[model samples]
Target: EDQVTQSPEALRLQEGESSSLNCSYTVSGLRGLFWYRQDPGKGPEFLFTLYSAGEEKEKERLKATLTKKESFLHITAPKPEDSATYLCAVQAYSNNDMRFGAGTRLTVKP
Candidate 1:
């Protein structure tokens, strides 16, 4: 069975606060791990693509890393504008459709 789970369904952070969200996955064969940021009422915006263990990618205040079993998304000195639902998805060789985590909703206060 392929699956994805995210921790801390919602998080409240003060301005410039740093934190990390976790995404755990189980799949037959991992093709790729994708990270995305989604604003209210809109589709997710791609943030990263981690292909293998120890692989990492970053954009602005966010960074994503992946391993065989799981992945993490780190936020560094987050601003209010950084607040959004962060989603993780996995692409498996066996299935072309992507499986998505419910997402971690972050709220950064000014």
Candidate 2:
């Protein structure tokens, strides 16, 4: 079965606190890995697309990297505005459906 799991279902971070969230995945012939950020009551916003091991992408205070078996989302000096749920999804070559992780909810306190 192709699946994705994210650790620390919820994270409370003081403003400026840095952390890394883990995403473990089990899939067949990974076509792509995607990272998204979602605020409460809204659909996820695309962040990054990682195609292979050792590939990384970054924007603002967030960075994402992918490997053959897993992916990581790192946050640096995050602010309250950064608080949101981080979601990961995997695309399999054999299907058009995208499977997603439950998500890691991050709360950045001011």
Candidate 1's C-alpha runs over 4 A off are: none
CA error at residue 43 for candidate 2, angstroms = 0.9
Candidate 1 accuracy as TM-score: 0.97
Q: Candidate 1's residue-wise lDDT over 3-92, tens digit each? A: 999998999999998999999999888999999899999999998988899998888888898888889999999999999999999999
Clashing pairs in 2: none
Cα error, residue 7 of model 2, in Å, equals: 0.6
lDDT of every model, 2 decimals: 0.93, 0.94
RMSD of 2: 0.6
Name the regions of candidate 2 deviating beyond 4 angstroms: none
Instruction: Evaluate model 2: give its TM-score.
Output: 0.97
